[model samples]
Target chain A: MRDILTIEAVEKKATRDGFGQGFHEVAQSNSDVVGLCADLVGSLKMQAFIKEFPERFFQVGIAEANMMGIAAGLAIGGKIPYACTFANFATGRVYDQIRQSIAYSHKNVKICASHAGVTLGEDGATHQILEDIGLMKMLPGFTVINPCDAQQTREAAIAIADHDGPCYLRFGRPGWPMFTETGSFKIGKAIQFSEGSDVSIFATGHLMWHAVEASKKLVQEGITVDLYNFHTIKPLDEEAILESIAKTGCVVTAEEHQRNGGLGDSVAQTIIRHNPVPMEYVAVNDSFGESGKPAQLLTKYGLGIDDVYAAAKRALTRK
Target chain B: MADIAELKRIASQVRRDIIRQVHAVSSGHPGGSLGCTDFMVALYFAVMNHQQSFNMDGANEDVFFLSNGHISPLWYSVLARSGYFPVKELSTFRKLDSRLQGHPATHEGLPGVRVASGSLGQGISVAIGVALSKKLKGDTQTVFVLTGDGELQEGQIWEAALYAPHNKVDNLVVTVDWNGQQIDGANDDVLSLGDLEAKWIAFGWDVMHMNGNDMEEVVNVLNEAKDKTGNGKPICILMKTEMGMGVDFMTGTHAWHGKAPNDELAEKALGQLEETLGDY
Candidate 1:
């Protein structure tokens, strides 16, 4: 885990900012990259892209399901449409549209959802969506991706344009420090940050930094750890997961999502298939989050670094 | 203008096809399919400017989307009889491994269906998006969408209803099959769709009403809707059609909305509508 720790943050930025930058830059080369928003343009940081490509930007005005249908239509017309909305409205509200029009029909649509999970902060359960990953991953032929930070989110948002199918690209609201440099984002490959022979720490989305911090604290306590970032959640990097589990024998999965059907369950499914491993999850238990500071909510909902550290210790005992 | 007699001939054939196809499967929507036959026949054979050869993007041509997709028998019949595919393929309706899915899906590679539409209220937004695409591309062709009045109860229909006119999607036309019957009962008994034309006008649409069961009227009003396009408003036609227009037993009720006919009833329904074009 020390290799990822050594890759220090250059600056702090939100994953949503990365998405905006990536989409704006991608629109320059691929003229087919049409953008759509349902009255959350500023919240999704799509203003700049809209200004540059005015004709391609469609403001659907508080109608998320219609926005999804419009994007599906555009995709059918040989245009790559990115339907941007809050994570809750993007997945839960328009699931049937996405299922019938995009996923089942296999249209080329990018469902770019921002301000996902509890880190959306102070918006309460209405705005914060902790179950989006679960909702999207269940659909067949959908590539579900939740990037860790700004640089990775930018890479993922741009990379999905070349993929000719429906995808759900998830990002977050709060700005945090960047940990890794960009490039080398394969669709279903896991990145091994650092190698250790004890308990493996698997993390995704904004809580990735928490897992890194957990490894740092665990190193000082002489519990060597292996760390990985599972960004592409649907195509769950099963080979890398089994390889990591082969060495570590146990796991601790951290994500800013519900415990039942988030990244943790994916890892648990993979482990039980290839190699059985005792696993502990650092995720929101079966409950909704209330309005609070992002950091406070992280700590309160058992997604803090200390929680990861404790989960790893617990997993080691099972091993 | 098309030969009204020939259009009526094709409409009769489409009605026969709808009855036979649904009867073959024993589990498809026959009421809406039979009701909307004249409108679809008039549109494909007389109204729209489209090509016989199908492509996915549908660049530089008028496009049609079936928002209420339970009437797959009607769509498949019209699509086949109009040369989008073989008329013989209509016999495969709703069968396993058939391109003609219970709902229209593009993934099945079926011609004339650009988007899937069985889930109600979703197709109008697709039509609007294609209209917007044509506007962006400077393509002059228009887009048409057909929806059921009962399907208007879905909240997404209103969402798409609010979007098309607000964005000035002028190069589009939509027709709602105001048959006043759903799978449950009469539309009034199920849930009243109060003041539907006023609802479309209130939503900023250039609203028109017509008797969709009349082939000549269906052709004329759809073309009139076409002429009204690009005048800075989308058009919505609240077409007044019977629940099952030509079938003696099925007409004026929702009993045959999704239920297929038994063998005896199929022969009886087929007897009412004479086949002007050869059956598949």
Candidate 2:
């Protein structure tokens, strides 16, 4: 396995920041691209876009449903609208608005959600939305993408602008490590960051860094493991996962979302359909997230690096 | 151009189509559809400068959205009669594999519908988006949307109501079918939407009220709405209408809000709504 632990003290930046940068850049070139933020200008990192193009940016004052409806309507007028808000409000609160107006209508709206999962620390379960993936991916034709780091998220946001359809781009609050290379994000393809043999550890969103760290620890312990970034949860890269797990004979899925309807569940379904393997999940169990620091929350909710290592070990044992 | 008499005749035919369409399916909302018949017919045939051949972008021409989409029967009838589709297709409403869904939708390539609107409180925002688009493109064309008084109870409606006028989405007109009836009894019984006109006025809108059932009054208000556009404020027409206007037994109550009439009721309703323009 490749040594991905060299950058132990790397500069940290929130994935939402990447979204802001990419959205602003995309809006500059594509005159038809517009943005609507539901009163989370600062948290969602949309100040730059709003600053650059005041005419195109809409401040929809804490009303996520209205923002979604407006985005759907904007799609009809030949404008690609990006609706930004917290994952909780973007999915759970305004789900029906997205379903009827955006998803069912097949509006060309980009639902850019920030502060997803337990990483949205100190806000408790109400703000930390662990179930947005389930809500979004279940909708027909909704392309669900959860980019791992800052560079990948920037590329993901810019990429969705070119693709035509309703999409849910989920990002987190924590200033994660910029581990992946710039412009490395692909829509439906998995990135094999490191190769191994004993087990294939698939991680997504903020969990990718932790999984990488866990792999380093496992490698020191003489356990060779394969690491794959399962960022785009829907339209999942099943071929890559099946091929990797076929070689490894076991798999461990990790995400900052819930154990039931997130990356873990997605991998399980794919593997069950194509190549059944002994799989273990390193994700938040059935309980809701609580107020704490990102690291504390990750460890408390069983999504820390230790959890990934433990889950990988369990998958290897099971196999 | 449709004369007052011709517009009234078209409305009567639309009412007939609504009844027949709902009765054929035995499912779908007919009360609201019947109530908003005149306004829809007036807007499409006379008021809005829209094309008979539907275009999704709606560039250079005015566009319409049915926010209270339970009244899909009304919109489908108006679009068909106005040449958006085959008038014969009205018979396939609510049937399996029909483009005329239970609610107005853009999917299935329904020509007239720009967005899906069965779930209430969404149409106004979409209209605001289209209006904003026109503003961005410097198109100067207007966008129109219709909502129910009951739909205003939805919180999203309040959010959109606050959004449009605040943003100066001036080239847009919203008409609330203040029929006073919802699926659950009257608006008073279901939930009192007290002082609706006052509410819109407070929300920074150009508010106007008209008797929606009166074809002449509806036509006059709609024409006035066009003149009122581009005045730096969103237009709201608080249109008062009866639940099932022309049908005797179905009127004055919310029981028939979603219920389709039986064979006898359909016959009686169709008898009252004279097919001035031949029915589908």
Candidate 3:
């Protein structure tokens, strides 16, 4: 297994690229695996799958709701379908399609959502949907995942195919630092990058890299904080969360999403029910994002390493 | 065999079940349920060659989706009579802790229901998805979906319509129950779906129209649709049906769209249709 960091060396690669690659790889091994895109072949990085398996790739053309229906139909005939589109269009735009056709029916379909959160820079508020996680996670029998990096996204693509029922795999457009090694991915398992009993930071997607950076800075200051990468948001590893909280007594959750229903809210709900712990949420504060570079938006919206650092400090004070 | 007579007998039995089920619950749509009885009976009994038992995967068997799921009384009746589940369960429609809810849902782990579809205009999409899946699996078995004419106003139906023909989903046979009435009033009165057949044909579907209440035509047209499959295009059959059939008081009116027949009205309705298949 190649290390995950080496896979990340190819800079400027969108997380969607990982999905496209994994899709092509799965198609080669399992002829039953097929790809569908809603006129976003180029945007969702599904061109590679389309080019490789022209017979298996379907271009539904600018209709997300229809694409979802088509994908569900494909699943009924025993084909594993990965429906690709932007995060906003995939979840919010066609939520009813997913709910009735896929989730309600328990269809084995993968909803691969690209350009998730504010990282889809320059598209502005209309394209930037910070509530997709909430929309998808709330559905019964729906598994929600936000891979930390490109390599993890690729593994998630293959892993989700093997699992039955509906799933929403969210990834971002902007490429960040890749920290995990290739082929070392596990679903629904939180990876602890750093360990400390003082405060635990649970983060996902692009925010995972930011949490890592903050951990390094905090380590220098002699504050040993436990850092966990929560790639799978739904079917969350509750045991891991409670174990960490039992040790830390205080927790900080981070994601590039709205504070209301994203990873922060999920963690808060779980912590309150299981373990009563002091926590701080590092997310886009009940607001929308505008057109800007991905890095600038992260900083401007208080989702950068600085925010994670501040949140860690706040969580420690609560402890 | 006289297809119309056989279908009418089956439909009469289904109608009795529909009224009995709704009357037992005191809530459920009987207007559309009764209206589409002839269509459902002809399709299940004479049209599709499905297995005796229901299978979710449906690998080698023909599949059917009730897109206008508000007509679950009719569907549940036909499925039970067709041996998908126990006929005794028919009395549990829309009751507390029953497998049958107001809208059809798979949450109860019902054998025949593949998807939950009370929210209008979603079943056609799911049926299309299942048809696509069947093609991918190399299964030649066809998928049939039934929707209401009023339900066509939903934008998602058009979205799925555009997708089906573009992808050459030839295994799908979509039927629109043109009852001409919705919950409020006539479909034209609510939101005019001008020239529905023309719209489907223009969307690249192989369009056909038939009198849905006539069981012989329903079966023959459906057979024609099955034979027309694998021709690189999806098939759509526009079925012109009465809002209520068999029951004299309910027929030819939208007033019974969802109104359950009371003890007096139920007696009147049941008098027109004899219980040939035995009431649940």
Candidate 4:
């Protein structure tokens, strides 16, 4: 673990930038690695990979369905295709395409989605996709990954290509906390931020930074908190979750997604089946987001750092 | 050649298997499966140059995808008889824990099935992807996809149609089973696909029409498709096949779209088509 930064310092770096940097780095090593964009190259920060691997990159224009098919086809020809598009377009618009051409075919395709959740900031309900995790996870053999920050997103982009099956890597557009140090990322391994006995805070994607901040706040208020970043949602680190729950009697899940089928529900389901534990979810409570600043939306939707802190306290009180 | 007659005999056996498999399960789309039997038999046996051992990557051999997967009975029979799997596995059609799923899927690890296709109008897009993969790898093998006329109503099919031409996907041969009838009624009744041939031609594809029930016509049109490959345009074969070709009672009827035959009906169907090869 590197130096734990203050919330202000961590908030300076964007996760999409990490994705862009990592994408370009991976393209340098692997010639067969290709990038496909559905007219969202600049927004998703995939222009770096496009610039680095011009011949290998494919600009599919606004046709997301065609982009998915082409990416699947590229995978069939021994090419590792990273398909970049907004979260709304990647999962919701072209779900049938991903289901049949990529997941069902078991193609080695990476669906790297950016601008996930209300954190997309002022893009409104049409751009924000709170149901992407549920949609991607329901697909059999599709690996779903939501990295914490820029560092984790970069690591996930480089690591997902080595994975043989279809993957949905969800990241956000706005700049968030960057806690992880620059290094290689391991998929399906829960990174523990703080070890405590009262309650476990399992967070994913941009919400991990908030969870860490909440954990620090809880510690000062005489509460011992355990925080874990669940980067991979599909092949979830069940052992890590079970181990944390065994130590802490209760759990609190945090994510910038819908409360129904996002990280909270996934963790709750696992805990109930494997190790029954009292759990609370800190997420947008089954509502579509509105146009606003990302920070304001997070606070309004009960997904801010304060919500995670409250959920941790409530979960701890449950035991 | 003697093989041509032998292949026809084998096709008869495959048709018997299709009827038997559908009848045994008491549920399956037999009309289209029976109608496309000769074309499938000719494709797997005479047309595609593949390896004895099946590989999903299909880097060195021709690849085929059944987009309208309701005809899995015919494809499974052809694959089993063609040595992709055991003939005995045909009995487990639609049964629990069987590789022969209601739709063709790779989930059960069934050989020769590259993707899942119970969902209509997704196979051509997948086939295009596979075709694109072949192009990227410098693999000279062609990809063949078969879709139903009714399935062409899906928007994704048009999405794929517009894409194949724009991308110069010349190694793909998409065949539409223009048999007119679907589950509800004729394709014209369900949803009129106005000028389907003209639609493909306008989409910048090299289009050809053939009688799919006739093995010779299928072979000729497919050969023409092969010759037309690598010409900067995808090939579309609008195969005009009957709803049911072999059995007189089931012919030109939408009632048999998914209805299995009773013992008497099965006997009558068997009477029309000879079991040239041994039944499973």
Candidate 5:
């Protein structure tokens, strides 16, 4: 999959747009697929789907709790309801609603969240959610997904629609380069970008683009970088993680999320269980993000391309 | 043309089952369960066109949700008497590994319950979702939900209350168990509900009122609520019930809300109500 990183992309799109297109496409094929939004029809990019399937769409006002309960109810009624809202409102605001109605009840509702993490920008700490992945992944029987780019987010949306049970699909607000191949999405399976023996790099969400950029520069410096994209956080691909770590003997995890409960912690838990490896995390260090440009937020939060490069170097030294 | 005598007999047996189940466990909410017994028994036996053999999707048939789920004893008794599960499972209320949890849940594959509800304020939203689903599929069946008057204090209840009528979710009936009592004390003492009837009317629902403890009234009002369905607006029934209705000692107070009666007290409570059906 080296060609995946080599493709110089001229097109850019937000992952939420991919979700909109993918959701609309799936709704066409399956009549059971329904859409529910909490007054974010445009922000979540669900206009086309709402226009085409007005009968299947439900506008639940700004009530996130009701939206979650309705999604669970729709699931009980045998409809695949995609309950859409900002990541903060989707997870934290209505945690009890989700815990009882959807997760504990074992309802098949897809909580499609957008504008996740520091990359949300401008809206600042209250709107930007850094702990969503941890909150959702902690719930029992929830499929947690944080796809890299637009094409992959779209593909993830379509794939999860067919995969039964409750899932949390987290995407972002800002536009990022479209690099991952379309229709190559698989749940709970990591994509190996390149094979090497120096240091293994694990990245998810918007950070994958930066990981790719940092890997190119590292390879030119004669470091063999073993890279993998972890889209699914829960039911993590431990087999792939162990295989890469065994080959490289060290690891660096990158994501536009808090270091506490996001992909970094997931990988650390896996490594501690099977093999103890020297690891470094390139993530927001136990801090709430502020209003800034997406790129500037990444730099301030220690999630830039240079951050990944520096983490990789730190892991190599420990090895 | 309903048998008021027979429904009364069933309600008595359901009340017996509720007391016995809670007494066996030494824990469970018996107050609201006792208070709402007539309404639930009337709904299951005389009101809903439900299948005794339960499925997740209650298509083409009326479905019910108990939003005030601490009263699992009441629902378990009614569901068992209605043949959703064996009547013997009434003995398993709150026991280890039993299908009957302290709160109504689908986790143990309990046939009648569609979702877990112990955390208040979510069940109304869930019922709305099912009602919307039925509307989408052109199914003519109605969705019913019961929440404690105290449960309405939850913000999510108002959120759903605002949503149902605005979206024209007409195939739904929500009945508030207006017992005026919560765990702390009277609702007035804990947190004033402040004119529930006017509140439902102000929220744009087609509101109705009934005495929940009266078996005849419960049956008639539920049938009336069913008749009101398929209109341009959703329906809400503000049901007035005593916190503890039947047993003389437990009645007129909120003290019995979550406490199970001791053996002697259980015997006294059972004496006031006849065992119209054999005990499990």
Candidate 6:
């Protein structure tokens, strides 16, 4: 396992790039894997697959609902369709289409959403979706995976294709650290980055990078921080959560999503059910993100490295 | 192949099933179900080359999707009478733990139903998807979908309307049940669907027209619509029908769009139609 304190992240790539590459790789292996885009082929990095197999690619043209239904239809027809769009359009805009056609029907469609959370940047609140985790996870039989970094996102794209049934794979826009190694990705399995008996830091998506930074900073300051990457938010690694909290005695959840229904809530629900622990949530506190640089948005929305650090301190104090 | 008379007899039995199913629950959509009976019966019994065994993939056989899923009573009757499920299951319509849900769902393991639908304006896109899958697999079978005239009000329907022709999805045939009545009132009185024929033609579909209630016309137009496929354009049939076609009191108004007929009313409705097939 790579140490969070000294792990080098020399390359920075957007998680969507990993999805595009992974999707292309999966298409190469699985003929049943078809690509459908809501006019965001280039943005979603679906071009490579489209170029390789134009016959299998479908350009749904700005219609997210139709794209969702079509994906469900394709699934029904024995095809594994990756319905690609932004997080905002993928979940909130087409919830009903997904509910009836995909989730309720139990169709094997992969809803791959790019540009998730505040990291979507300048497009602002309209494009950045903070409640997508809640929207997707609430659906029965939905596998919601919010992979951290490019390598994990790529593996997720390929992994979900083999896993039968409906899935919501969320990735982001900005070029974040490509630190997580390949072949380490698994759905519903958490990656424990460091072992400590102080505050356990559970993080997902873009905020996982910040949590790593926060953990390293806390470790330098004589605080033992247990860090785990919660890639799959729906079939949550509850055993890992309970085990970690049992050791650390307190917990802190970090994510670039709403405080109400995102990673924090999932962790809280697990804790409340199992062994209750004093927990702090590092997330957007029920406010829509505004136009700003990706880094500025994170800091402004209380999802920065400092936010995780502060939240860890609060959880530790309560413990 | 069953002649028009036999098809009409099956349709009469289906209408009786629809009325009885809705009347037993007293909380299902009878108006549209009653209205679309002839079309459903003709398609299942006469038009589409489908298997009663019901595989979800529907490979090598024509697959049907009921987009306007509120008419579950109609679809349940057609599926049952055609031997997709036991005809006795019709009595359990809208009851607890029934395969025949208030809306047609695949969740309960309903044999004929491939997709869950009660939310309108989604079936055409789904049909197009299945059609695309058929084309990819080199299967020449057609994909059929039925939508309500009022369902066109949903933006996703138009999105599919734009998509099918642009992609040359020719193996798909979508029929709009232009029943003229919705839950509130007539479509024109509610939200006018002006020039539906012109609209589909402009959307680049091979358009056809038929009276959905007339078994012969329904069978012929559906076959015509199927034959029109694979020529590089999707087909559309603008089917005109009365909302409550068989039951006198249910017809001509949208009042029975979702409301079930009372015991006396159901008996009266059953009195008009001869149970050509034995009642379930």
- Please identify which of the two predictions, 2 or 3, would achieve the higher DockQ against the true structure: 2
lDDT of 1 by residue, A112-224 (tens): 99999999899898989999999999998999999999999888988999988999999999988788667857777878887888989999998888888888888778888
Better of 2 and 4 by DockQ: 2
Query: Interface RMSD for each candidate model?
Result: 1.0, 0.7, 1.7, 1.9, 0.5, 0.4
DockQ per candidate, 2 decimals: 0.77, 0.84, 0.69, 0.53, 0.91, 0.93
DockQ: which is higher, 2 or 6?
A: 6
Query: Residue-wise lDDT of candidate 2 within B123-235, one digit each (tens)?
Result: 89889888888898999988999999999999989999999988999999999999898987888998999999889999999999899998888989988998999899999
Instruction: Write one digit per residue (lDDT tens) for candidate 5, span A1-319.
Output: 7543475545889999999999999999989999999999999999999999999999999999999999999999999999999999999999999999999999999999999999899999999999999999999999999999999999998988898999999999999998887657899999988778999999999999998888888988989899999999987999999999999999999998888899999999999999999999998888999999999999988999999999999999999
- What local lDDT does model 3 show for residue B193? 92
Better of 2 and 6 by TM-score: 6
- For residues A1-319, could you state the per-residue lDDT of candidate 3 as single tens digits? 2322222334546677787788777778888888888888887777777787887887878888878877887786678889998999999998888888789878889999999899899999999999999999999989999998878888898888888888899998987666676766778888777678888999999998888788777878888777788999998988889999999999999999999889989999999998989999999988999999999999999999999999999989987
Candidate 5, residue B60: the lDDT equals: 88
Clashing pairs in 6: none
Model 4 chain B worst lDDT run, 10 consecutive residues:
B1-10
Model 4: per-residue lDDT, tens digit, A25-84?
Answer: 888888778898877788878777777667777777787887887787777667898999
Which has the higher TM-score value, candidate number 3 or candidate number 5?
5
**What fraction of the genuine interface contacts, i.e. the true contacts, does candidate 2 reproduce?**
0.81
RMSD of each: 1.4, 1.4, 2.3, 2.1, 1.0, 0.9
Ranking the candidates on DockQ from highest down gives 6, 5, 2, 1, 3, 4
lDDT of 4: 0.86
DockQ of 6: 0.93
In Å, residue B112's CA in model 4 sits off its true spot by 1.5
Q: Look at candidate 5 and give me any clashing residue pairs.
A: none
Candidate 1, superposed: residue stretches over 4 Å from native: none
Per-model chain B TM-scores are 0.98, 0.98, 0.97, 0.97, 0.99, 0.98
Off by over 4 Å in 6: none
For residues B1-280, what per-residue lDDT tens digits would candidate 4 score against the true structure?
A: 2256777788888888988998887999889998898788888888887886977778968889998999999999999999999999999999999999988988788998987887888888778877877877788888999999989988878888988898898999999999999999988889999898899999999999999988887877887787788999999999988887788989888889889999989988998888776777
